[model samples]
Target chain A: MSAELRRLLAEVAERESERFARTHPDDDVLLYERAVAPRRALRRTAQASGVAAVAASVALGFVAADAVVTDRRDATPAASPSGTSLTPTGTGWTELPEDSAADAWRVSGRPLDAFFVPEGPDEAVLVGADVTGDALTTCQVLDAFARFQMLADAAEAPLPEAPLSSQRLGGFHGLGDVGVYEAEFTRRAGAAAYLALMVEAAQMCRQAVGGAAVVNVEEDVAFSAVAGGGMRVDISRDGTDPWRLWVHVQQGRMLTVIAEPGGADEVAPVITSYFTAWDR
Target chain B: MSAWHGVLEELIRQRRSALVGYAYLLAGDRPLAEDLVHDAIIRTFSRARRLENVGAAEGYVRRAILTLFLNNRRSRSRALAKQHLLVVPDVAPPDDAAGDHDVVVCALNGLAPRQRACVVLRYFEDLSTAETAERLGLSEGSVKRYVHDAMVHMRGELGDIDPGPEPTPQSVVLVKGGAR
Candidate 1:
């Protein structure tokens, strides 16, 4: 064993551990009382009530999931089925229930229609759709590779050359524009590879905005799979330029929502609502 | 509600700092480390029967943290692109003095997840090779290989850090800098 390596490890151990311990300075008593005690009580209560408690908890969980979905749609304007013509069925394409939020943003006055396309033999389903508006003009489905190239250029991050099918679905509208952008590609590559590409694009955006008026940035901003693995990048300066840049991924699908901070509803729930239904 | 609370509270009182430090070592990010510790505490207390002592509970909780961390590493969410997970929101430029720390962490981050875990457990936590293998559910020889590989890589990245002492018959071999 190299003596120098041991010394470095020891230094890392001492420095990092000390910094963590010093900075955290959390209270043990509060944690026990606040976090541990409640769970303990719940366990006891559940044990005693047995079937009733179990039933109640299940109901509560369902209600929670429902509430989450509803809250997400609160800000989304209901889609007027009047404007959206029904696509003929049996093309392995499933029409998304008219979502007002999906219908709100437009490109060249055409109401962007959302749907699911099942995978076909010899090709993964091109769940071909994208949101292109003020912020997402660069994110067109056909230009995904160009978009990745652009992001790599801006962020100085290494990115694989966009897949042959790499189609850019949307681009950032501006500093404070708010809108929803969704894109799915049935690449020759697997879902995992697509997911990686989407995540890289989001990360590139996050890195590019480093010098901008980013007030708060929460990485790995969520824990639940339902929230769609995402990050919340809050950009505000002087309490005026408040906007949220949310980039979320599920399976191979990528959803990015840019919204004014004070908007009535969050984009997370809306994305979750659509994805949950798609999953079903 | 359960005897576990009494045991958990006592353990927290005694070992909260150590637990949090352990998590920080594994996670690198402070907030995630704290969250991991909190989650580990809840999980360890929630599932285990009332162990007789704090030492036993500490062991349970630490193992839970390691298991959770490793499992999380393998989980799909972290695969949010290869280096993307390592991307921090850069609000300000980092100071020059922090270079060594970042270098070490970057090197550490470069290791495969299991290798990183084995190295942390063996060197940072000062666990014996067998104990690290047991904790990770890997063979001792695997642990040695991981350590050896990790050390060799770190030396390349960091330039001649000490790899500590040679292995006895009972201990696993720790590769020195000049070996490979």
Candidate 2:
């Protein structure tokens, strides 16, 4: 009976296969090209950088708490480079001075000015003020961290065994503004581990930020791993007024960039700049 | 062109239709079957794998398609949870009742995704129960149960169909290689 059933199944499969083949005959060359484009671009970037197969760890000095406070008072409006428009149209984020923390805050409609308090050698808390000079309390920053930790613990499976050190919390710009937080592992956590954590974290953030902030996990948008040694996961929120949570892991460092009402184009360059500086 | 690119182009030009058809049998949707094939191709070629020839590349792509299909099914609930955020809904292709194989296809779709996959791998792909279990990361007992349940359901739908002698099983070549 099983053999007879198998023969019948094979016959149906062959007929349907032939029908499908006749109906959709043309090869989609465009889809193939689009799928491979990112890979080609990554190869070019690696070749141009002359940094292929070179993994170096540069210790970035913990930003002085006083420095963050002083920089806010000295914040200047972003200046576009000559011959190229640096700012994306209709967005507060400017492409110029790609590594400026001040410019990073502009997307959230806040000045770069913020107070940084050192929590440990590898951890710091940032407090940013609004237009009215109202600043987030240290307790509020800790509360957010607690929430993230709680969500991580509640995940179905435990995160990777790699201990996360070098934790830094970016300034809080209220519930409406973008928030940034980053950490580096004491040891190298494999790319797969980081990707898993990114997905779990993205889902957690989606639940934490109620209201139209849905997570998008389509192949092109959700997760992409660079050939050499980097993995990027973008969990985009709803369209037009999109909220993007960009998680990137390179070397042993993991940077989470959350931008309310921003696009990947806006946050991507900033992330590149941050990694580039770290590599140096 | 690079060797991998040459292999990729040749596979697409020669075996793309067959791959799409195989995916269609598993997915029961033409557009999704196309996506599964394209995604499988990209996944195979993106990483640095030593594919000695077009045959090996095709094998890799077939394996990728199976993996992707299963993973997509597993994540369907998560994707549906945020379906409203999608700019365009992913509507399945309309079923054409005019086909001679509609009964079989409909019965196949009636089974759960894993059960359908097991049946396709077992009967359509002509893989042994152990091979099917290995491919799907399932225990052999589980594969048997799924195939058994699926056949029972399919027989009910395809009542009194003529069961001809079993055809010769086609050999499926899967190449093994470590990432470079």
Candidate 3:
């Protein structure tokens, strides 16, 4: 590097450092603890449990574990099955893996990925979407979701009491009159970002009046068997379409299931079957 | 907390400014840069229980910061691309009022993430090609290519303006936002 270049770099670095110090002069310790303590506790808990706390729950068929790991080896991109239009367009949208869901829903959109709409007997569509950008701003993400729902406005649908798990990502699944919805099934960089978005959603939900918003974050994750790196399911309401339940799962990736609100007994099987299709 | 924890905490307090600056270069935005550094420090301390060496701890944290920035950038590209698919106009106005220092920062930002990282690591941190590659999980050749491309970009954008002698501490006035 030239002498001038080095001087410029140093100047920029020094000024930037000073700006950070001035703005966050007192946050070093608090930020450190907030970032480290929970992670350390999670690590200790995982160590004590032997296997991941959530992976064990996956064995019970309570939730679908193991992020996008299932689809990596199956490089064979199948043709879009009978009912869906899941073409891998040039715009970088990955082809949806062949799944039972493919038989019933047509998928569209990029990044938001698959926006499924049921084609035959299936009552709901599955949307595999992701919130990506410079930062995953909660308001922006919620806005995008709301914007996409151009039909009836999506209000903050109250999250049902979800089974809590000790996995890297929280997952939720629900089936009721409010409309079945599951969200945050795929893991991301970490659970902190996931939790942050959820908190933002909750706050927005609390502030929303007369259900003006499209989706709402659920509350009360039941804290028991939900303790593995397994996925937890949270249900949000699609007020625009109440008979159809919306499932949004975000872990490292995102998987959503929109199904007709059905019996409580049918919730688990329906969700697991969708996961099976997602994996296939 | 152990005595080691205290040592780690003290080290963080002392070097937080430098770490935040390094992250800001990578993340372009101030708040996101702070979040990256914060997460990197937490990750380093949480994983390395036996923090016998503060220097190595700093290095580990720096690497974590780079990885976090890169991962977020990659994910953001996909999301931004997808958002573009929604028939929205995504145009950013060029910096018209950038000062000399702001110009330098903007030039650095223009490079692709990997190339920009190479410049920061190789030139700013004074890391060797081998070390940069190892830290980035890339081969030395790749690091060299990135640095070469970055330098070409810097030279093109920076031209040959003389920055004069390094300003003394008292001479340099620290302002609020720079190259933001």
Candidate 4:
């Protein structure tokens, strides 16, 4: 780089450093926080708000373990996922994988490639590593159930008619060719709750206030159980749209977050946190 | 100080703007940048004591912030940007005064996210080839090349150094909203 060019670059960088906050608006802080939240996937526990708590306890079969981690924070050393240890790096946090953490309540560094809910929500947590450590995969699993319930409602359909198991992705423990069906099934697992939601959403989708909206986030995920990572399903829709739907069909873990209209912005980061939790 | 507190205070002192600005650009929005920076700082602090080899916490914080920034938009961030862009014109400009450098930013917002990030990081951040490499987790050579390529594209709207395949766009609006 030329001296002048370098200087130009420096000057601009200095100016932006000075003007960073001004260039973007405040609401975007929510957006960025939502985005960053996922990268860390830091564990959080916010109180479930309003219907979120009620609907969660109902037919949806989801627990509204909503945590308002108002402060963007890394999981405490004590709460860090099993086999994960914290090493103070710069300002915030970084988690290094341990050879092993307590096994009784554990989370794997190996990607959560497959999910099988035999009876579902046993005293055990399924995806605990992403939520609150080796604690209860409870909140995350419930969160998933809630989100899937929304999906089921949107398609105007019911849950899978058949039992699903013994699927692999790229010979790995994951979804295969039979994946799209599974994806469809999972997206709308709580049929009764979804159907009920559909009626309400349908009414809102047409109302003056648009009464209410259902929004969610999707990332690259193999909608197929047989395939591991081929295509991606990316769906990003929130308030700006009276209605928005995102379907992620890529070859990676699936992180779907659902929220009501007014609650969309607030819930977005939580959803992203699920993803970030996994990535870290 | 507890390692956590030490890291947080040190990083807050070192990279308040660099980290925040990098995050803001990655998010393509302002408030988001603060959130991202704040979160990244906290995470960086957690790992602060362990960051042995690095010189300034800024180096580590910048990298974490960039990683967080790049990873934020697998799909959703872009859609939000498009929606926001379409509406900004409808909403009045937040400020009336546009500085010379502001013109450069205006031109930048016109480019794609990665392109804009490349431009901003290269020009605005003035990151060294090595330092930029560290921040983006890219190779120094890659940083050198991206910077060159971004500048070439920028020169057209920035005031003509070379005209390449990418046509000269009529307007490039650099996002200029911030706390200050």
- TM-score winner among the candidates? 2
Expressed as tens digits, the lDDT of each residue in A1-280 for candidate 2 is 5576567566665655565555555655545644443333222222332221121221111111223222211323233222212222233232223346433444323332233221210111121112110011112222233223322222222234333643434433443343445555564433234434344333333343334234353211222212112323333233344444555554445665555443344455434433332221
lDDT of 1 by residue, A1-280 (tens): 4545545566665565565445445545544444443333323322333343223223223222434433232323433222222222332222333353343233222323343111110111111112112112111211232122232221212222223322322221222223455545353122223333433333433343333333354544443435335455554433343445565544335565555545313445444443443321
TM-score ranking of the models: 2, 3, 1, 4
**Which candidate gets the maximum DockQ versus the true structure?**
3
* Error at B83, model 4, angstroms: 21
Cα-based lDDT at residue A171, candidate 1: 21
The 10-residue segment of model 2 chain A with minimum total lDDT is A127-136
lDDT over C-alpha atoms for residue A104 of model 3: 30
Put the candidates in DockQ order, highest first.
3, 1, 2, 4
Candidate 1 stretches greater than 4 Å from native: A1-7, A26-28, A41-280, B1-7, B73-99, B162-180
Kindly indicate the candidate among 1 and 2 with the higher DockQ.
1
True contacts recovered per prediction: 0.34, 0.24, 0.41, 0.14
Per-residue lDDT of candidate 3, residues A47-155 (tens digit): 3333322233333231244443333223233443232242223322223332424333232211122333321101221121221111122232332331122111111
Model 4's interface RMSD: 8.3
DockQ score of the complex predicted as candidate 4:
0.08
Q: Model 3: which docking level applies? A: incorrect
CA lDDT, candidate 1, residue B152: 76
**What docking tier does model 4 reach?**
incorrect
Worst 10 residues of 3 chain A by lDDT: A150-159
